[model samples]
Target: MYGVFPYNNVMATTVSRTSQKTARIDIRLTSEQRELIERAAALTGSTLTQWTAQQLMEAAQRDIETRARLALESEAFDAFQAALEEPLPDEAQQLLARSPQWA
Candidate 1:
């Protein structure tokens, strides 16, 4: 039953102390997943906690690279700047001119 889940053992315990830093966080996971990490850790000669950290770090890096880029090309950037530079709300100014002001 335990053999049903798949894992990438190559990334299991390959930690780099030189370029890495530590942070403490609190999270919750299912017992089955926890058990799986424990088993993987044992098989890979790593602590369950360390394996989880490595997986998190790799996932975070991937997510940041994929989601966090300011990704406009040069033509789009120029167009966006031009749009911002253009005048705004001439109709709003006309409406304000027409509206009655109470003294």
Candidate 2:
């Protein structure tokens, strides 16, 4: 359940996302998937390509964010590690202790 907070690393600061139609990528999807995407695109009033691109960008952002690592000051690091190492609450410990019996 620990969140890997971001470190001080950053990608190049691009002034803006490219908007020119300068590249092409092809993706294959099952009929059902394509239908679902089409429906979603219709709902958002965007073309299939536009909707797909937006969805891809959003997913990529989430993926990168999750993989980010924490870079904390020494004091902050000590505090964070201290918090993580604290014991689970009694009720949670009790529930975990009983989990094996459920199986």
What tens-digit string does per-residue lDDT give for candidate 2 at 22-94?
Answer: 7889989999999999999999999999999999999999988877956799999999999999999999888
Q: lDDT (CA) for every model shown? A: 0.79, 0.84
Spell out the clash pairs found in candidate 2: none
Tens digits of per-residue lDDT, candidate 1, 25-45, equal 877889998798899988988
Q: Who wins the lDDT comparison?
A: 2
* lDDT for position 90 in model 2: 100
Give candidate 2 misplaced runs (Cα > 4 Å). Answer: 1-18, 71-76, 79-103
Q: Provide the lDDT at 15 for model 1.
A: 44
lDDT of 2: 0.84
Q: How well does candidate 1 match the true structure in TM-score terms?
A: 0.45
| TM-scores vs. true structure, each candidate | 0.45, 0.51
